[model samples]
Target chain A: MTPAVLIEKLQKRYGTVEAVKDVSFQIEPGEIFGLLGPNGAGKTTTLRCLCTLTEPDSGRIEVSGISVTEQPRLARQRLGYVAQEIALDKVLTGRELLQLQAALYHLPRAVISDRIESVLSLLGLQDYADKKTGTYSGGLKKRLDLAAGLLHQPDVLVLDEPTVGLDIESRLAVWDFLRRLREQGTTVLLTSHYLEEVDVLADRVAIIDQGVVIACGKPSELKDRVGGDRITLRIREFAPLEEAEKAKSLLQTIPTVQEVIINSSQGNSLNLVVSPQSDALLTVQKVLQEAGLPTFGIAQSRPSLDDVYLAATGRTLLDAEIAAAGTRDEKAERKKSMR
Target chain B: MSSTMTSTKASLNGKVAVAQTPSSANPVGDFFQETIALTRRLFIQLQRRPSTLIAGIIQPLMWLILFGALFQNAPQGLFGDNVNYGQFLGAGVIVFTAFGGALNAGLPVMFDREFGFLNRLLVAPLSSRYSIVAASAIFITAMSLIQTAAIVAMSAFLGAGLPDALGLGLVALIVLLLVVGVTALSLGLAFSLPGHIELIAVIFVTNLPLLFASTALVPLAFMPIWLQWVATLNPLSYAIEPIRYIYLHDNWSLNSIVMQAPWGQVTLGTALLILLSFAAAVLLSIQPRLRRSLA
Candidate 1:
């Protein structure tokens, strides 16, 4: 079977900034694919190029085997896109908005009402169908947007950051809905900054950083590939930088300890990667005590998706996000080139 | 195109993965479906809000009553023989109100762009993006005519009197033509401009100046020679002079002189022809811009 979505050598530049540089990925039919990245990592740009909203500077994107740039209308027919920001007309009621979406996708007049009813029920929007969307909570608004996207019953559903700023319950509800979609054989592709969101929903994940896909695989497989047991320790709730650095150097000398870094953002905690040591947590606590340092907190766990990110990028995902948010130039943001 | 999309769907009614490889894809049918639905959305917006439509109707009536009173005591024969200020101001108010309404055709589109609602439309599988442009033109033209009807009714009640049925029809046609041109230009701006603020600035700067320079307010004889040239060149004046001719004259004909411009005399027929050419020219000139943005 043809891949539901394929993007190769994708690159988009707004002036000197290469928003999507050499990014490529493909999703098999019925698979949930996630493009995981930080805020300025170009996930949205890649989705835009695939959806034909913005032309890529250089890339080949296919939806159900249709070239997005060559036969955009046909490609669009095969893809349903829900952008990161939900764009509902406040004055339009939920039902009316769906009707408009139905017409836009060129649904036959005869089948439109049936399709609308099915989607409304699927999203549990029956009770709010007649109510104007301005009164909807964030959850209801997102559900309505999703229903509109699915009305055409596209082969693939592409979402950009499906659960940003949503309440936990709403986020889970969206995730459950996506899982159900995959069960029904609809291919799914989404971009998300939330690590757990991708880990939970995507069958296969791609880690995008600075417009490049640094890693892609099943979540567990990627984590195992970067194999290590993890330990998080802190000298105090807010350890001094000098103490954290000293602990980092001392931990580095241990045979069981593979690597250590000071996580300054998290109250100067120390994150360590140790080769499968059963007493890794106890070893760290003993070393701290030996150095006249008090262990405020310590824990051991298996590697997480964040460890895969850390192994490749030398920084945690949260740290990358903080750095991106701080260093985002307002002028450059202005020139980010919206469609 | 078929070479690119090879999804072999047995049915196209419900599943749109390939969007009707239905053996008979009608582009015209798809265009009409989307355009009508989009136009319906605008009408629904008007029905729910109603405030903008209310203000639009009330504002023109105020212009008629207040402006008519402002010139009520003018000397006789100042505008024309046996013509009252109320009678002369009726056409100006109608034409100017429609012009203002037409100029605002882009405001909603601009807001959509700013708020990302347009992105939804952009990513959809539209048969032709011109449907978006067509919808705005239809909605604005209909709005201009509605406002025109309200003004004509109020002017008649104010003792300005009504024209014959044919005259009224002609008034609607002139307004429709002018609105079409201005609406096209405004929609072009909506797509080309970066955001809503810039589009609003363009509307603000052009709104009153064009009204003042046109024959909407005064006859060509009342202006200086340079102003007469400006008024004759103004498209709004062409729409106004014809409708004004229909109102003031009982035996109106196509060849009847509507205004004496600085260049030469403009008959009712010449005024309409000029309006026609203006509308056609604007529609053609803005095509490239619309195609760039919508394509």
Candidate 2:
């Protein structure tokens, strides 16, 4: 079977800036695929191209087997887009907005009402359907947006930063809702800057940076390929830089530990990468104890998605995000997204 | 959550199964459905917030009452044979009100674009993106007609006198043509301009200048030679002159000379044809821009 969504060598540029230099990914049916990237990493640009909102300068994008560039209307029928910004018509009641959405999607009149009812209830928005959307909280508005996107039962649902500013409860609710969508056999593609969100929700992920896809695979597979266990050990609640350096030096001498770095942001905690061993945590504790370093907290686990990003990009996602933020032109970006 | 998911999954499967057969769908039927639905949205907005329409009607009535009184005591026969200032001002207010209201048709669309609501419409499988344009045209035409009715009534009450049925019909046709054309231009600007601020600036700069340059506030002969030439070329002149002729002349025909321009005498039928061409030209010019933005 054809992949639910496919993109190859996608390239787009805005004036002098190369927004998406080279990116390629394919998402199979029934999988939750995540495009993980920092703010200016061209994740939104790629999604815009796929949704046919903006045309790419070069490359192929397909929905199921339909070419998005050649047969956009047909592709649109198969794809549902929930934008990062909640685009609810505040003056319109929830049901009215859904009704407008149903018409825009050309959903058959006979089934439009029934479909709207189901999606509203599915998102637990039945009680709020009659209320004007301006009265809704952020979570409710996002839920209504989701309902609008799913009203036509699209084969692939595309969302951009689905839970970017949502509270923890709302974010978790969105995660659960996405899982339910996958269970119902709708392929989902989402982009996010949050590594933990992608790690917890995406079945497979593509980590993009500076207009390129650096890594793509199942989250667990990517983590495993990074090839080590992470041990974050705090020498004390707020260890001195000298103490952290001393712990790093002592920990680096062990045969099992392959690397040691001081995480200054977290009270100068020592982050260690060790070769796979059953006694990795015990060995680290013994080394710290021998150095007369008090272990305030310590944990060891398989490598996380962040470690995978770090291994590929040489910088943490947060650092990339802050750097990207400094360089982005908000006005230009908004203009690009508008049309 | 698990139980709800299970039940939803079953129903969703059923719904998808029903929607899978796309072969029987009718494109033409779907286009109308979407257009009507979109048009209904504009009407609902107008209904809930009636301020725009209310203000639209009241503003023109104020102009007629205030301007008519301002020029009421001017020398007799200064405007034309046996014509009161209110009589001449009727046609101008009707045309000007429609022009002003139609010029604003893009504001809603611009707001939608800024707010990201236009993306929602763009992402959907629209039968033809022109439905957006069509909906705005329909809404503006309806609104112009209502405002025209109010102005005509107020003008008649102020002693301008009502036109005959055929003349009233002609007045509406002229207003419709003008509104459709202006609305197309505004919507085109909405898509092409960067933001609402820029769009509003254009509207503000264009609104009063166009009104002043037209034959709305003064007769063509009453102006300086340069101003008369400018007014004759104005599309608003074509719209205003014909309606003004039908209101003043008890016995009028297509051959009736309605305007005395420096170039030549413009007949009622010629003025209308000019208005028609103006509407067609604007609508055609915006086609490429609409395709670039909407298609």
Candidate 3:
């Protein structure tokens, strides 16, 4: 069967910045495919290309069997796009906006009213349907946006950071709605920076960094591929660098200890990766105890998605996000997104 | 297009087809459905927020009253044979009001872009992007007619005299041509400008100056030789002159000379053609820009 959405060798550049560089991925039907990355990772650019909001510099993008570059209208017809920003007309009520969206997608007038009602109900937005969108809270606005995107019954719903600024209650509501959509067999392609969000929702995931797909597979598969059981030990609530360093050196001597990282951001917590085995955690504890390292708290678990990212990219996702934040030229990115 | 639409259905047939319809595959039907729906949206916005319409009507009436009064006492025969200053000013006000309103046709779209509302429209499978342009043109033309009707009524009440049935018809035709051209240019600017602030700045700079430079404020005869030439050359003059003729003369015909510039005599028929060409030129000029942005 043709993939619901296929993007191959996708490349998009904004001026001198190569926003999407040689990225490629295919989203199968009936699964939530997550594009996980930091802010400037070219996720938005790739989505823009797929949505036909921007033409790719050179790439193959297809919605169903329709090549986006060749027949954009058809691709658009099958793809429902909920942009990162909730872009509702303030003067228009929720129902009015959905009605307009139905029209733009060319739903038959006879069915438009029903479609609008169904979508609003599905998203729990019926309460706010007649109220001006300007009066909506952030969650209501997002729900309305999602309703508009789904009003056309698009085969593939392409969402760009759907729950970015939503409150916890609203975010869970959105997540539940997405799961229901999958149960109905609609394919979902979403971009998110939240590690837990991707872990929980994505049936398959692609971790992208700097315009490249670093890893792609089931979340469990990717996490296990990094091949280690992890230990995060805080010698104290806020361990000093000296104590954390002393613990790190002692823990490294264990033959099962594959790697050790001192996480300064978490109050100098020692993050250890040991060969997967029943006694790896016990072995590390015994080694640390011999060196007089007091373990205020300790936990052991399989490597997480973040560990996979760290193994592949040499820095933790949070650290990369922080570095990217400092270096990102927001004014420049705004100009790129403007068109 | 057929394969694309069908492929989506085929893959999701197992369970997602719950929403499927018997006639889901018709592209032509869907296209019309969407375009009409999109057009209806603009109408709804206009209905709910009638301020733009209200303001569009009021500004022109104010122009007719205050501006007409400013030149009310001009020498009796100065404008033309048997034509009062108020009569002469009627056409200018009609054209100017339509022009000003048309000049702002892009404002809504510009605001949509800034607020990311255009992205919503862009994401939809619009049968043709031209529908976006068509919707704005339709909205502005409807607005121009309303403003024109008000100006005609107020001018007639101010002793400027009414046009004949045929003359009134000509007035609408002129308004349509002028609005179509100006709306096209405005939509082009809406796409080309970086933000609404920049678009508004362009509108502010271009709006009144174009009105003043044309015959909207005064007739060509009272101006200097160079000014007369400039006014006659202005596209707004082409619209203003013929409508002005109908307001002042019930005996007006296509062959009647409506404006005399330093360059030559411009008949009512010639003026219409000039406005047509101006509309066409403005429409053609923006195609590449619109295609780049909208495509």
Candidate 4:
């Protein structure tokens, strides 16, 4: 059989903004795949195209070998989309909404009740099933949304930023629920800007940036591919530019150091990428001491996904997030999302 | 490499559930199943939050009583031959109330779109998304009928005089056709407009204007030449004239002249045909918008 979801040469444009450009990925059945990107980084756009909410200007999207463009109804049948914003009729009880969902998916009457009960129980929503969703807390609403998405037992469950705006407890519950879903052999695809969320839950992740897939692989493999350990050495708490430059120049002479970047944002701290070794830190400290540079603080660790993002994009994820946030026109985006 | 493992895993899971047919057992059966399911949702909303429905019925009754009292002292025979202004206004109230309620049929859908609830529906394996539109139409039509009954009773109590049973039945047919047409236009607006705010603004702008321009509050002969022209041309007048004719004339027939438009006279049967055509036209006009938005 074909992969659970296959998207090839996906390209979409909104006005002059190329929201998703040349995005392609195959999700193996039963694996949790993550599309990772900061805000405005085309993650949601990709999900929208996959879920058939928006048509791609050019691309092919397939779910279970069915072309979504040509046979959207069939593809939609195979896909369950959980949007970032949980939408539930405030007046209706949770059970009522689920009943509606059962109908929309056309579940057989004989099994609809059993399926609703099972899914509600699976999501721990049995106690709150009779209450109006308007009274539900953020976590309860999300759980209800999850229950709605899974009501049909779709072949692939697609979630867009599922845990955003959720509290820590609710976030953990969502994560646990997703893990249980994966264990049951459902293909899961989710998008998130949170590095750790993707790191922990996703079996494979694609890092999208500027409407392109910059890197994709197992989290550890991507981290390893970036190579080496990162060492952040500060000459002083507020090092002078000259002092930071001197330390950076001194560190450059070390053969173990492959790359050195001065982080001016953090009081001129030196960020060094050094080949993995047991003695790299000691070697750096000794060199700094001989150079009369006092070490205010230093940390060394294996490269993380953030480090991979930094190495590949030349900017940290945090920086990209801030930039993306500033440039995003929320009003315009909300309008675009309406239809 | 992992592909082989996935296939094995999928088959393994498939065995646990024998009837692992991805497609429904029968698509034809599933279509009705889902359509009913979707329609049931709209009804549940009405059951739980009956406020809109309550207000829908009450507002028209209020218009009948308040407008009737306002015009109680009007000169006798001012409305038309052998009918009080209150009775003349009754048909207008019944038609206007249903028309106003139907005009708002799109608000819920607009809210759904803004809240991203529509995205949830679109993502589902719906037989056709038109089921969403159809569900709205069904719900609104039901509400219109209830309001129409309430208005009919209130009008008779106010001594506006009751139409005979057949006359009341004809009034319902007129209300249903008008509601169907207006509801379709409203739903089309809901899909076409960018947000609920815009939809409300359109509803706000269109609501009272349609009422005032039609024969809802005044007789066509009572208006200025231009206003008379507007009243005659208004679709609401097409609906109002037939229902008004049935209320005043016990021995009504299709050939009876129901309305004296500025341009010409419209017979009772011709008025029904016009309302039917209006409903069909509105439904057909919105098809492209629905196709693009729902597609």
Top candidate on lDDT is: 2
Q: Which model is ahead, 3 or 4, in terms of lDDT?
A: 4
**TM-score attained by chain A of model 2:** 0.93
In CAPRI terms, model 1 is classed as medium
| Candidate 2 residue pairs in clash (backbone atoms < 3 Å) | none
lDDT tens per residue, model 3, B1-295:
3433232342222323234331354656665666666667777788989988888888888877787788788888888778777788888889988998999999888877777788888877676678888888887888889889998898889888887888899999999999999999999999888888898899999888788888877778668888887787789988988888787777889999988888789999999999899999999999999988787
| Candidate 1 error regions (>4 Å) | A329-338, B1-24
The total of clashing pairs for model 1 equals 0
Q: Pick the candidate with the highest DockQ.
A: 1
Tell me the tens digit of each residue's lDDT in model 1 across A105-216. Answer: 8886886888888889989999999999999999999999999988888888999999997999999999999998887778999999898999988899999999999999
For model 1, give the interface RMSD: 3.5
Q: How are the candidates ranked when ordered by DockQ, highest leading?
A: 1, 2, 4, 3
Q: Give lDDT tens digits, candidate 4, residues A1-339.
A: 689999888999999999998899999999999998889989898999998899999988999898988988778877888899999998889999998887777665776777788888888889999999999999999999988888777889999999999999999999998998888889999999999999999999999998889898999999989999999998889999998988888899999999898887678998899989757899999999897789999999999898988888998787898888889999998888887
- Going through the candidates in order, the fraction of native interface contacts each one reproduces equals 0.59, 0.59, 0.55, 0.65
Of 1 and 4, the candidate ranking higher by TM-score: 1
How many pairs in model 2 have backbone atoms within 3 A of each other, for residues 3 or more apart or on separate chains, i.e. clashes?
0
List candidate 3 stretches off by more than 4 Å.
A234-247, A264-268, A277-298, B1-32
User: Which lDDT tens digits does candidate 4 get at residues B1-295?
Assistant: 1111111223212333222232634656656767777778788888988888888888887888788889889888898877787888888888888888898999989988889988988887777778888888888888888888888888888888888888888888989999999999999999888888888899999999999999888888889999998887789999998898888888999999988887888999999999999999999999999998997
Error (Å) of candidate 4 at residue A175 is 2.2
